[model samples]
Target: MSLGAKVAAGETRFTVRSPHAAAVDVCLFDGTAETRLPMTRDGNDWTLAVPGDLSGTHYGYRASGDWAPERGRWFDPAKLLVDPYAIELDRRFAYDPRLSEYGADTADLVPRAVVQGALPVVPPAPPRFARGGLIYELNVRAFTMLHPDIPAAQRGTVAALAHPSVIAHLQKLHVSAVELMPITAWIDERHLPPLGLTNAWGYNPVAPMALDPRLCPGGVAELRETVAALHAAGIGVLLDLVLNHTGESDVHGPVLSLRGLDNAAYAHEPNGALINDTGCGNTLNFGHPAVRALALETLRHFVRHCGVDGFRFDLAPVLARGPGFDPAAPFFAELAADPRLADRVLIAEPWDIGPGGYQLGQFPANWLEWNDRFRDDVRRFWRGDVGVGLLATRLAGSADLFGPDCRSVNFLAAHDGFTLADCVAYEHRHNHANGEDNRDGHGENFSWNHGCEGPSHDPRVNAARAEDLRAMLGTLFASTGTVMLTAGDEFGRTQHGNNNAYCQDNAAFWLDWAGRDTALEDHVAALSAARAARRAEFAQFPQGGEWLAPSGAAMTVADWEDPASDGFDYHVGGARHFRIRRAERSAAI
Candidate 1:
């Protein structure tokens, strides 16, 4: 811990917490070649005396110790292991069982070597994030794929996010934080690739700390630069963290990172079998102390090294669930108390596939959740279903869901489901592209085809769909609670009939840089204009507001259920809509 012992000009001192490894070598690489230097063990630490390795040197770890799989140690001297703190990766991981510990289970494959910054990692981010902050959800690839101004080399990577075009786009949108889909290193489901598809959105996480090579431009600095640019624009970046489960497929899944490092720590399956909660193959058990430590360390590492402003937990409720998905689990409470994460902008997906798993308003006040009810209601109303009264309840922040203080994150669409355009153009999910035979997406989209399915030449139908788009997005941005608009929603991008294109690599999911509709663009502009006008007049976050329902409609759960009886109905879709009134009581933001 002292600088008295100086390192050579290119030589660096290194340490690891593996006393059991008979020998540890620092495998150094200078972009092209690699050299191995041995490390000596002293007590619990292994110290490496490298021969002057430069900053950009690519490197990995080589440990000579136990190689037993059953006992949980898979150290192989032949394999060049990647450092957990790697800042850069050379390539995206291909979904091969060779990447896994077993043949196909992802819970077994470890990460590849990457270059990290030479400076020491910083401490945790300040525990400070404003409540009622507007969150913008986006997928890294989709957000910039069609951007004309973004450089082709940087497009779709973390570097693309920092481009002026991206920054300008977000500023225009006016959302405070950007909730990015899982950026951590992950692998697409094997079925998709053979079907000629790529995992467009990274939901299946392999290594929580490793950056997905596909999205990395240079290294951690690529992320740092992107975050810095966003901060300069007064925007925060909230990573959609995947902790509930891993990319590791079912019992026949691959063996990647954690499965190789310590499967017992990361894998949460009871009796070493998969739990279907995450809908992913395996889950991370909160019961293990090491798992908790590693998870916490991973979070701390991200905040320190990556400059992430906040984390949107993919399956936050799973973190709180006990042995049997109990609500008051220690993990949630622990994260709430951890100084590292307490004041962070914690958002949750709020539900998993587990039994009794949907806890909409159950999370504590510190956390905001993806309000599925809001999406359903708004979609129902826009799609012109009957009984559309509940639209106001959702637009009013779902007091039914959020209660006295907690606010729900309401949205019309997100990365996981149907896009706003698809919500109207397509009636049912077209997930045949995902190789699940159309069974991958939800059947109940709550979307209407407006008297016609798919695209139409009838200007009336087009006009109707356009109106529906405005109504939904307008309501989302103009509502109470923290609003989260998906990346492509603003431009009214459509995924054709592919509602659930989780694994479509082709042009089907990519943003069409050339085919933008001007009318829809104006609609998006109007939505932003409304939000900005209101936001400028009323203080953001925590200051009160009264959405004085414009039509002078009073909202209640009863009225929302039956639209014809009241003015509107969110469930069956109706005619009447409600508005709000802002209370600008506080001057201080």
Candidate 2:
């Protein structure tokens, strides 16, 4: 019996792609009693006519095979498997070695969630706003965990997104979108377990189709309500999707959902063992037909079923990379043609931590990419790196990177790095607090800690830092790419230089709403509004922008500064804070 049909509430139908397992059994648990039902084989798919209706039944597949650790054949019949189509979860997973035959801790993991009804019926995905739309990237738990205004029950849940206080805040702020960090099911690393840290920025995805129950108070309904409310407020929701890899870490990793389903098909490999190209171990192989189908299925699931406006692919370069890393891989072409996904925003991280993997500005038309170059260039310039003398190109639109083909997802900071506050204040990564002895986060941050290493009492340094924040944030709003705002970076959120706060679910990652920085907040609100107005003006760019500089001739700093030069700038600049006028007339982009 296939897990999908079983979860649809009829007699369970099971299928397994593995021709290797000698025998397969579908075991059902009713809390008190356990029933073992043997499956009849048809090729590799086993048919089971289980007698019972299971709406919320707990189950696992028992395959006949030796528990051979050497050959990597781990078939434990005693272990209870989770329903991949389960609409509801049994309970929050705790990292425990007992969960698997091996003593590795896979607890804080996502129990295989179900697809509920077969084929997974979903509401139509809404239209995606343009590149100029504002995105508020945040952790669901941290967004409302400590808010005073959010109801106690709703705090830190998907319902918190629609809470009056949240709505009031986002609506008042005038942000066009909100990006939830890893709302998909995820698992925390074993080392983070003792520190009581969780997968705060959920890169470890357990189920691509299912929402992490931890983020929703009333499960799927609550998540649906949150999405609806955000739409009602005119805010589009973008999910941070980890399609480059899965929750399963390595061969030593646990037998999680995807690993158990189709190991060879779904993951990458070099010399037979799964390749850890994403640095998160077990990269999903989009090269495989079944894996590609799963990837397409996952996207369809979100677009049609989840009602999300778009997806931000984490480590997206791998998705485009094929047999090796090919920018124009069939995977991209397939998505580009998928009518269901064609309209929704497709934002890629554009690079993976692998050899020959960093592909920027290479994606097809209509896709938006996270421009790491923007972040690096902006940091280098603000830090007084004279090497960054050529930012006028980037500040203008990064046409060198994304060109006219695709728009860029530009920003100064993201969830995986130090917040803007830390970038200007701390010279090195401060991850000792992360329990990895300061060896966890990235050290090559291209950051310049102006006159201090962490927080300082010096007014000169602090004021300069504030100005730098404004400069970067200002540059982001001022640019032509799609700006993705890391949750509290607007108001000087600091991870104390802890770039990777995937764990540390506490205040380290959460937005401390009660403790507001009035001045920075106001400045951000104004800057964001200005950026938005300019974006609207330049919505249909090249089409809207008047030519300031000719294609062959170099645009100089003097021309940019000289107000007297008939040289008007195409950019509308900020609403009030700044303005630029171009000399010649050109079409909008």
Q: Which candidate number would show the highest TM-score if scored against the true structure?
A: 2
Off by over 4 Å in 2: 1-3, 6-10, 51-53, 66-72, 83-87, 99-128, 266-270, 387-389, 540-589
Displacement of the residue 540 alpha carbon in candidate 1, Å: 9.1
**Of the candidates shown, which would achieve the greatest lDDT relative to the real structure?**
2
lDDT of 1 by residue, 26-133 (tens): 666664456788877777556766555445555566666676654546555655555543445556666764554422222123344543435445456553235544
Worst 10 residues of 2 by lDDT: 580-589
Per-candidate TM equals 0.82, 0.87
Error of 1 at 199 (Å): 1.6
lDDT, candidate 2, 1-589, per-residue tens: 2334353345545554444566777666565465678877777566576545555565556565556644546555544444444445655555554555553333233353332434334556556466677778888887788788888877878887887778877865677788887776667765567886767777877656566777763666666667888888888888888887866577666666545544664454444676777898678777776666667767776667557788888988778656578767888888878988878888878887777778888777777888888888867665545232344556556777766643877788888888888888888887876777888878788887766788889998887777777666666676665677877777787787787776787765677776767798888888777666657543433443333433323346665454344322343332122332222211111
